[model samples]
Target: MKDSLLWDLSDIATNETFPQLIADTKKRIDKIVTWRKHLSPQMEKKQFVKMLNEIEDLKSVIACIYDYPALKELTDRTDIKAREMKATALDIVIAAEESVRFIDHWLQGKDVVGPEKLNDEQAEVLFSIVPEHKHLLWRSRELALHTLSDVEERIILQKDLQLSEPLLDLRRIIESEQQYKIKLDGEKKTKVIRTQAELSKLTTDANPKNRESAYRVLFKEYEKNLDKYFIIYQAIAKDWSSVANLRGYNEPISMRNRANDLPDELIDLLYSVCSENLGIFHNFFELKANLLKIPKLRRFDLYAPLKDSDKTKYSFAEALDLVIDTFEGFDKDFADKAKRVVAEGHIDSHPSPKKAPGAFCATIHPKITPYVFLNFTGKTRDVFTLAHELGHAVHSLYSSVNPYSGQNPTLPLAETASTFAELLLFDRMMQLVDTETQQKLLMERLADSYATIMRQINFSMFEKEAFALFAKGTNPEDVSSRYYQNLLAHFGDSVDVDQIFSYEWAYIPHFVNSPFYVYAYAFGELLALSLFAMYKDSGEVAVNKLKKILTFGRTAYPIEMLQELDISLQDRDFWMHGFSVINNWQKNVQNIFSHERI
Candidate 1:
């Protein structure tokens, strides 16, 4: 089936208009709050079950209400109506959070005086009435252990909704408003570049001058507003630290680790393993520098193509077909689900002015089809991105059998399918290309691995240090210098670490929007590498195991879910094994170059 180029949002609210949907959502919120306010420990099983059902319905309605505006805004950041709708939706949802907290507290039996555990029959009946509540119960109990009083929790929630969230939106608005006018070859007039998606295309331009100019213009524009970005980062960091301290977390990252159900030690181990194996990427960079015949690789040269080989742009249809075929080769079901994302009008596949720069799959609710937003430029990486986002959509579809609460996985496991999809696409490309093209493809694949794994890990390292510096009241300039040092550590002597690149951190939305979130990319990429190896060795059996894992969603802890596939996150050697895969690729590239020299 042919995929639609643009996503259809009408299906999300077919019967009602945006204002009507907002009003309906408010009614559901009222209903939920009323139920929660009347909740008591002495309530009967029937009453509890009724409340759970209402919560489930409320979740579905709220998800649609929030998601519609979110998707609309992302598709066109310039849309005033979309932005207003998003703010309205966020207001309603933030209010609903109070009710949610109450329910969770009650689920933890916090209000009960010497509450007794439910018998098996009673438990079974409760699960039967609201199967999703089974997952919610565990999460609620886990959160209850770390939760503060309702009053304190509300304060934090209010600060987040009123302060932190608005700051993030302001940063995005500022970024979207930036326009870099640069002269292009064969064009008499300077092209106005607004989105990062456009700037990205120029980063890989065949001309070194073009590449350098693009980098400078992009960074220069951001430099002009560096103070604002820094202030935003500072406020976010302080807010995060304040909340973390209040919650008794040792560090801001520790709070995130707890949220992901990941042990601090496991994350430490992963970071250490990746740090030790930085040499593999260093070697890749040295090789790239040699290929470019430069003394050292510049920041702009980082994404420079090894060869101008086959700049053939794939149309949206062709990209979709390629992605579907790659997934089909692995499993027809995977491909079918990916196709359904398009067929169901769930994918926005074109780039436009004021649209979000990157791609993402938003799984709003378990019952609702996931929506994917993409700024497709027809680059090969764009194809991989399409596959990646579609992989996320498929993952949501796989977990759709679960309740709304259980439909989304932890952040680390959330990236598993998306990165795995990229790997699958890489493998498919390797098979289709000629020997010379295979070498180029291999280099491209390794470049991606370095970007996704090492680059992200380096970003996390900067966050680790930046957080500490922020606590010490360090200025953004000092923090930028520290980030430069982090880049130096990653690149080592293989590449030139320009001073200007220090300002690059100011543009990273993750640091401000989601603190310490970059590490999940490294974690997911490494884990996906290990999982991809398992797929190659065990084939269909491993594929089936992966499908089962995706179906888990947030039902089980991430580590426990992986253990089902005989994968141990705590095993130090398991992470090193992912490095070994990269090392082998490095060796293959070395051998390819050696053969060419002869």
Candidate 2:
């Protein structure tokens, strides 16, 4: 159930004080960056340690202000004290960067502090900000924004290096049509699909005829203009590879794992399991075809309407009520926060052309911790998306309370609470509905779970093989062809291979926006589902343990975090529990189909 109490930001009383706070904070931080350049690019190791301390001190102050309730929300005093506090902290960050710049300046050969017998506190400065974001917000920038300027240094040190240039360019490609051309066949078409968000309306169309055509028109444009987009991808790949080479990582992907601090064994274990279990998805597809009484299940049919047209269509308000009511059943604390967010206007439920595709929660800095920019289109699917994104907001809200903290958990860990909440709500929703609706709901879950499991794992295999082929000096055509061939092998005979093949990868936003990121969905979903099984068996005790992990901040690493729920990353049987849950649903779907044939 979704919490009805979520509010839109426009309704929040941020008033004059909040705006000033944001303004002053930006200015203060900007100056700090400027001052740091006094030190040469290469400071002695000793001087670098001194600069790190100054940063830790600034983070402590920022954390204090963030912990303050008025700064977290709106000021009751209207005194603009929040503004001053924000600005001062921003100034400190600027100073921290200046210290880095000073180190940078000294690297070119200049005098600086020595490591002569520094105390334990001085040694711990960098670690102090590890789980907290106060310094990372800048350190990552210092490494990336200065990329071309300090190429050798960047490649060597920054496995954790964040690059906004590629992402910024991607955003431009999505929003700006004139910047990127769209072509069809051997000819360039005047009718270009402007952005990825535009494709969402196209891709999710109800009619299969419409969906097939929409995808064709949309992908034809991408396929023909491959050189342009491929060039952008090439640059990103080349840069990442170069940086990885510099960092002494075996590959760009290895560098990513290093930066994320993710265990290679865990990743390998996930792939090994998923690869062996692909038949699960194949069975799911066959079951869907049976229940729908169709001869074969095509890719477009995957997201088709689960129930007939006469079934209930949820209004946004009704959906909100259901979501709110569902979550309240879990506990009152969850219910109260949800109610306030809705009532106070913390959500932007409407979707627009200018807004980005997909939904995410940005803490927007701990001092002014607010969730921004949601795009909803009133589908029952949208209801789940709302629950999912709100879960992100809830997780972020908890993490933001401390200020100067990392936004939330590590990537895989971040999805745990959000997906778990959805399962909790979905399960209860199933219990309340009639038997027919229950069947439909179970079908939806089976479809969704298969996608989370096989679709993503198949994608991971595609990336690995594609990149491996590329490493052997393969051309774009070879890579594309190879990908299409493997996709057919994965999707099998159930889908319209000719129409949806090559262009399918074109629409995957994750491939363009976040590389090697698809696996996390399967990883998180199965992990959460397995944990949900425990809850069903143990009830409230299980729920309490999971909640503790969510609120633990990033103090715990990924493995340690899972321990809170007593879920094991090491045990194959743990994942098998969730797989069996889907398998059980498949049996039900199969039985329905068997009867329908009569």
Candidate 3:
């Protein structure tokens, strides 16, 4: 809820001299390995401990740079700040990549560090991803960070967004807009601030007319310069796809699945099953439309708020209180540490210009702790977003102590704790709503599912098709037009998707950004729902098991982590059981409407 949390990178982060930091970390890591190699087979005690301490010191530096960007400078803003940040990022990346190569390409050849020091079960866990590539172990400038830099340099910053040979010179215009002295509305009175912040908040204004006007303004600007946003997105896809190919991946999906250690069967199964069940989502949406007393659902109606209820506006302070209270019911230790996150400057919870929209949690370093970011606007969804990201923070916290590198969960497992936390809050609130307001509450809950499960699944489907098209050298216009058409069909005839949503493609950072990341929302939400449903019968012991699962991190593959909960997701019935719950819940909704007559 706190809008701005101070970042303390100096303590754990690199000294900003990236080259020196990389050089120093390399020395420490090499020493640790050297000591390991020299230790006599009979004499492995205090010497090992000393080596671990040295490794921790180096990890602290690597994590601070990658995890907590908001603290050091180049956040989603200030090109100048990002310049130096990029250099530091490059150093961190190169360090990681080199480390991974040494362990996988080099150490494996040398025959060292297997499951003996670790339990056999623990040793089996090393089979995930690059086992040699632990958290800070395989920091590669080439993988994510450097790719981002190269793209930004050649695509985002250096090459203009517009596609023209006249050297359009739009950056200068944008920079001038930034400096234009003008007063924007809202929290900041008509006081002069930078134009970027002013332009952005205009879209999120409380006033519908203002929000609509802001949308018009945005597209008008973008429409005139469609070439830029389009070209950048195209280049990014091309670059990532090419990189994936060069790295010997069949496609981006392989790389993604590899990160999660998911088998081809599991992923293929998830895609098939989730796609097959859009009926449950459709039924849920139809119920929502009936509750809202509308003939049809609109694009805007998809996120429409409930009416005639006690809507208590929560300040940032109030929002934090609600979160701490809800999470405390689950685990006191969790609530305690969550408060520390607030006390320290871990959360950046405010809307600002040039800063990325949406919320995310950063796993800075296992040795330190994780941080959460949000653009809290005191809305109902904002509270849940906070809870969701907190789930990620707690998950990261448990994985920190696990010495094994795989403790960092895959993307599917990544969303489990966060979405589970949200369900806890949602179910508790749904139970408390008044009889007359239950319809509204049900609609609200259904809307959340619609976004997470329904919409995300649709996005995944679109990405699958679109990426395939792009890979064959389809032009940007063809990709964008096809994407717009697909978005319309997915939403169904209920929504007037023709207007107010076409430009949606340009704003979606995920599709242009991270390929195949959206389905994990649908995957984790259903998994969490299934697991939470089990808690009703299992009781307190189940709660402990849930916490233990979070601690599993990368140690257990997605399928194996479910095993800890005694639920195997691969079981056709286990997955269908998730669908059955949704059907039962939808029936409950029908009953709620039916009981209205009684």
**Model 2 ranges off by over 4 Å:** 1-23, 26-208, 291-293, 306-311, 315-317, 351-358, 365-369, 376-378, 400-403, 493-496
Model 3 spans > 4 angstroms off? 1-57, 65-69, 72-100, 108-235, 246-250, 291-293, 306-310, 315-318, 333-358, 374-378, 436-438, 471-473, 499-503, 579-598
Candidate 1 residue pairs that clash: none
lDDT of 2 at 240: 60
Question: When superposed on Cα atoms, how far off is each prediction in RMSD?
Answer: 3.7, 7.8, 7.8
Cα lDDT listed for each candidate: 0.82, 0.60, 0.62
Q: Give the TM-score of candidate 2.
A: 0.74
> Candidate 1 at 357: error in angstroms?
4.6
Off by over 4 Å in 1: 1-4, 15-20, 73-84, 111-132, 166-202, 213-229, 352-357
Can you write out model 1's per-residue Cα lDDT over 273-346, one digit (the tens) per residue?
99899989888888888888888888779988666555758888889888899999999998898888887888
- Candidate 1: lDDT of 520? 87
Number of the top lDDT candidate: 1
Clashes of 3: 14
Worst 10 residues of 2 by lDDT: 67-76
How far residue 310's Cα lies from its native spot in candidate 3, in Å, is 6.3
Per-candidate clashes, comma-separated? 0, 32, 14
Error of 3 at 118 (Å): 19
